[model samples]
Structure formats: structure tokens, C-alpha cells
Target: MKTAIIYMTKHGTTEKIAELLKSKLEPGQTQIFNLKKSKLIELDNYETIIIGGSIHVGSIPKKL
Candidate 1:
């Protein structure tokens, strides 16, 4: 299976979590994208996708 981890982090906590997940998952075609610097990616190519975000001051980022 193919997987993509797309994440946006204000303080990088979410990015770390994404990395940990990637490390624990079974080996396969996997990619990670940081929303802050990545252009629109073809998420359709991935059969499974994970999105990560964080809350700050009781509010989540608009990108999430």
C-alpha cells in the first residue's frame, strides 16, 4: 500500500508525530509533506493518507 503523511505544524509537534508514525508503519512507498513549504501534492496517488495538525490557544490552524 502507498501512504502519504501531510502535515502542518506551528511548533513542529505534529511533524514529529508524523515521523514516528512513518517509522512504525510497514515499509512501502511513503512520503511526507510539510504544508508550510510544499506545493499542492497529488494526494490521489496515495491509497492511504494521514493528516496532522496541532491546537494552540484552544484553536487549530486554518490549514487543518
Candidate 2:
């Protein structure tokens, strides 16, 4: 199976988590992106998608 992980991080923590997940699930297929300068590929490119948005101060980033 193939997977794509999309992440938005305010701190390094969320990005680290995304890295871990990618390592276990997709390995070389993992692609890290920041909301400020990130692009989305077609969802059909991968069999699965894992979207991660950081929650800070009780709210999630709207950009995710």
C-alpha cells in the first residue's frame, strides 16, 4: 500500500510525529510540507492519505 502524509506544524512536535508515521508507513514516499510553502498533489496519487494539523491553545490551524 502507498500513503501520503500532509502535515501542518506550529512546533516541531507535529512534524516529528508525521515523520514517524511516514517512516513506518511510506518510507521514501514520505513528503514533508509546511503550510506557508506547501503544495497538494492529487489525492488519487496515493492509496491512503494521512493529514495532520497541529492543535495549539485548544484550536487547530485553519490552513490544514
Candidate 3:
């Protein structure tokens, strides 16, 4: 099944996590998108969508 690891990161922690997920789920296909800078506007192709983000000042980011 095709999957997407969509995430937002301020200090790259979220991107790192996404990378880990990508490594584990390779051969399927995975890409990490920064919510603030990414232009991707659709999610129709992903059979499974994994959203992730990092916490700053003990609060979750808006992209989470």
C-alpha cells in the first residue's frame, strides 16, 4: 500500500522522525513535507497518511 509521512518541523526533529518512518517503510514510497514551505495541496493518492510534528515551548506546532 502507498503511504505518506506528512509532517511539519521547526527545528528538524519532525523531519528526522519522518525520515525514520521512510527508512522503515521503504520500497513503498514516502516523502516528508514541511507544512510551512511545502506546496503540496492534495492527499488523494495516499492510502495511509501519517501526520507528525514537533513540540516547541512544550506546545505542539500548528501543523500537528
C-alpha TM-scores of all predictions: 0.87, 0.77, 0.77
lDDT at position 28, candidate 2? 68
Candidate 2 positional error at 10, Å: 0.7
lDDT of 3 by residue, 1-64 (tens): 7787878887887788888888888575766666888776478987789988877789887656
Candidate numbers sorted by lDDT from highest down: 1, 3, 2
Stretches of model 1 off by over 4 angstroms after superposition: none
- What TM value does model 1 have? 0.87
Per-residue C-alpha lDDT of model 2 across residues 1-64, encoded as one tens digit per residue? 6677788887678789988887777456656565656765677877778888877889889888
RMSD of 1: 1.2
Candidate 3 residue 18 C-alpha distance from true site, Å: 0.5
* lDDT-best of 1 and 2: 1
Report the Cα lDDT for candidate 2: 0.75
TM-score, model 2 to reference: 0.77
Candidate 1 clash total? 0
* Candidate 1: worst-modelled 10 consecutive residues by lDDT: 23-32
